[model samples]
Target: MPKALVTGAAGFIGFHLCRRLSAEGFEVVGLDAMTDYYDVSLKQARLDLLQGPDFSFVQGRVEEPGLLMRLFSEQRFDLVFHLAAQAGVRHSIEVPRDYLDSNIVGSFELLEAARAYPPRHLLLASTSSAYGANTEMPYRETMRADHQMSFYAATKKATEAMAHSYAHLFALPTTMFRFFTVYGPWGRPDMALFKFTRAILNGDPIDVYNFGDMKRDFTYIDNLVEALWRLAGQPPPPDGKSVCAEDSLSPVAPWRIVNIGNSQPVQLTDFIAAIEAATGRSADRNLIPMQPGDVPATWADTMLLTRLAGPITPIPVDKGVQCFVDWYREYYDC
Candidate 1:
């Protein structure tokens, strides 16, 4: 079995990825800081489940000095999935430094670690926020994402550029995927679906941002996990031609950026309806204006993924929301 290393293995997405990779015959090494970013218990629970014969968990922060370097030196990873990130749009407003520390500095450290010991394929998790201020509906990977709307987006965009430089100069085969608004079982508490579910379940009023007019390309976790697994083996080569046309695939370097999303933008109200339907409870919603550093909508033009993977993996919002609601109820015993 090939060796795989995934950072932020305790995170919702990372946890799912590690579990899938372990199931798919990879000797997985999972790393996480286990920080109280949202809920440490949840992170611990995610990590605890990964403890098995094929999995090894490393407890450490990615930004910590000499930590990743040591791990890289000790283990020759066939693939390195950097999923750990300081993720938040509004929180970045409160503490912009955290974004810089985790997203930029930590990514630099990972590139340095990879520089010393290169993996067969290095995948970085970017965000759709990197497509900041690009009003183009259904964000494509090749769009001009020069104007970042938030510090979090800036740091993530910086990581993409930094990774590209490493790929071009050091010959590191890199794949960067811009994730849409992902939600599902074991999802982040900071996200919309989880919060809405919790508030509705507890019979509390839920804040409907953008006056409930916003649209999100709500991606299910399983679809994202499948995309990552498929992309891990499809890194661009050094001699590949940059797709000059409008597409997400990289042209010059052995690095490409693709969007992983459901490709369907469901309205916030509709999303809540799904939650309400799933939980059998109508939510008391407090309509609010758009929060700062937030886009009115986010849609992913997953044409590249569709062409490559043959019809983008999609889980209907109703079904996906119900799955999450079920998991939330079971996990919290609500």
Candidate 2:
């Protein structure tokens, strides 16, 4: 069986990826710090599900001294999925240090460990927020992402550059996947979908930022996980030439940055309607202006991922919303 080490195994995306990797017949090593960013219970619940015979758990911080080095020395990971990060947009404004610690220093530790024990493929999770204020309608993999509104995005973007440099310098096979608005069952509590669901179900007013007029290219978790699993085996080869001006793949590294998103953008109001339909309650919305570090809309250009993953980038928003609502209902018994 192939061995894969998944960081942030207790995170929303990490949990889904871990489950998918285990199902795909990989001997998965799940590592998580189980930070109380939201509720530790939620993290524990996800871990409980992944705790089967094939999956092993390690409770430790990725940025800790010698933690990754010791792990790499113990086992040769065929693939490494670095999904762990301090995730939050507005929170970064108040606690930027956490982003530096987790996304930057943690990734540095992981990379240094990989430099010691090279993996066949290394996949790192990035965010569409890294696009910053790029007003491009459809965010392409090949775009100038120079302006980042949030500290969270800056750190993630920094990690991409760091990973690319390592790949170029050491010939490490690396893929940095930029994800747009991922949501589904077992989603993060801090995300809009989760917060909206909780508010609507509990008869509380859901905060509608930007007067509920924002749009998002919300990628369903399953579709994103499938794309990630397939890409694990499709590592990019060294492309040491500046062949063209259009390509985003690193010219001197075995690395590529692919955008994974639902090509369709849905209005925030429509997303709320999906939640309302699922929970049988119209939301009492508190309409507000767009917050700092918030974008008005995000739509992805998935030309590269579609070519690689066969035209199935995102599930319908209504279906995806219903799946989350159902899971939420069952999981919370409400």
Candidate 3:
């Protein structure tokens, strides 16, 4: 079986991705810091489900000086998925140092490790927040992403640049995918869907940011994982050949960025409505101004993704919301 190393394997996306890789017959080694950003027990719960012969877990921070180097030297992973990071737009505002350490320095460590022990493909998770300040709808991978509204986004963008340089100088086959508001079962409590479900079920008011005026291309967890599975097999050509006119493949390096999103921006109010429908409860909507380091809207352009990995049909908002509620009700016995 092929070996894969997934950093941040206990995180929302990391947990789901590890499960997917394990199911696909990859011998997956998951490494997580298990930070108390939200709830460590929730992460431990995810890890519990991931325990198996094909999967092993390691507890440590990716930014630690020699952690990644040791793992890379030992495992020599065929595939390296760099998904570990301190994730939260609002939280980043309060603690910029976390983003700098985990997102930037951690990525640097991973790159150096990969440089020493090269993997066939290095896939890193980026956020749609990297598209900050771009008024353009349907964000494309080739678009100029110079202006970032949040410190979180700025650090993610910095990783993209850092990865590009490594890909150029070291010729590492790297793929960075930008995720747009991913939500589903086992989602993070900090995310809107989980918080909305919890609040609505408990008869508490859900805070609708931007006074329920914001829009997001909320990609479901399964759809995002499916896209990632396909992308893993379709790494950029080492010769730097473009797949099509819309290809974001670099001219000098075997590196590219793709937007994996639903491509349909849903209003924040409608998202809350989906939660209400799922839980059979009415949400006390607290319309509030947009938070700092937040954008009014975000949409993704997945043309390159489609051209590269075939079509990825997204799950509708209501249906996806229902799935999460069902999982929450069972997991929490609510």
Candidate 4:
């Protein structure tokens, strides 16, 4: 069986990816720090669902010295997914040091390890927030994303550059995918969909930032996972040319960046309405100004993703929101 190493295995995206890889007959090694960014119980619960012979769990920080190096040496992963990072825009503002440690230094450790033991494919998760302050309607991989409004985005952008250098120098096959707003069952508590669901079910006021004028191209977890799985097998060659016209293939390395998103931006108010429709409760809106490090809109141009991974049929926001609500009720016994 193929050996796969997934960092941040306890994270929302990492958990889903590990489960999917394991079910596909891969020997999966999941590494997570299990940080209390929200609740350690949630991470533990996700880990419980992934416990099986094919899936092994490791409790450790990726930023720790020699942690990833040791694992990579022993496991010799055929595929590596670097999904672990300090995730949170507002929180980054509060503690920018965490972003430097996890996003920058942690990635440095992983890159060094991958250099020692090269994987068939190394996929790193990036965010659409890296497109910071751009007013572009459909943000594409080829667009300029240098001006990041938040420290979180700056670190992610920096990682992309760092990964690219490794791919160019060490001949490491790398693919960095930019995720829009990812929401689904087993979502993180800090995300809007999860927070909205919990507050609405409890009959509490849901904070509506920017007076509900924001928009996001929310990608469903299942669809994103499928895209990721397919991409794993379709690593870019060292020829440094795009197979498709819209491809973001690098000019000097076996690396590329793809945006996995629904490609359909939905309004914030409409998103809340979907939650209301799902929960059968009207939300008490606490309209407020847009917080710092927040963008008014985010839409992805998924042409590159489609070209590389074949056709991607994304789940609609309303349907996706309902799925999360159903899971939340079942999990919390609402």
Tell me the lDDT of model 4 at 110.
99
- Per-residue error (Å), model 4, residue 136: 1.5
The TM-score between candidate 2 and the true structure equals: 0.97
Q: Residues 1-334, candidate 4, lDDT per residue (tens digit)?
A: 9999999999999999999999899999999999989989999999999999999999998899999999999999999999999999999999999999999999999999999999999999999999998997799999989899999999999999999999999999999989998999999999999999999999899999999999989899999999999999989899977787778899999999999899999999999999999999999999999999999999999888887778978888889999999999999999
**Model 4 reaches what TM-score against the true structure?**
0.99
Q: Which lDDT tens digits does candidate 2 get at residues 1-334?
A: 9999999999999999998888889999989999999999999999998889889999999999899999999989999999999999999999999999999999999999999999999999999999999997899888989999999999999999999999988999999999999999999999999999988888999889999889999899999998898878878877554333444678789888889898889998998998899888899989999999999999988878866556663588889999999999999999
Candidate 3: C-alpha RMSD to true structure equals 0.7
Encode model 1's per-residue lDDT on 1-334: one tens digit a residue.
8999999999999999999999999999999888888999999888889999999999887998888999999998999999999999999999998889899999999999999999999999999999999898978887889999999999999999999999988999998989999999999999999999999989999999988989999999999999898878777778876544655555677888889999999988999999999999999999999999999999998878866556655999999999999999999998
Q: In angstroms, how far off is 247's CA in candidate 3? A: 0.9
Model 2 misplaced stretches (Cα beyond 4 Å):
240-247
For this target, which candidate reaches the highest lDDT against the unseen true structure? 4
1 versus 3: better TM-score goes to = 3
Residues forming the 10-long window of minimal summed lDDT in candidate 1: 242-251
Give me the runs in candidate 4 sitting further than 4 Å from their true place.
none
Per-candidate TM equals 0.98, 0.97, 0.99, 0.99
Model 1 reaches what TM-score against the true structure?
0.98
Residue-level lDDT of model 3, residues 183-228, one tens digit each, is: 9999999999998899888888888888889999999999999999
**How far is 48's C-alpha from truth in model 3 (Å)?**
0.4
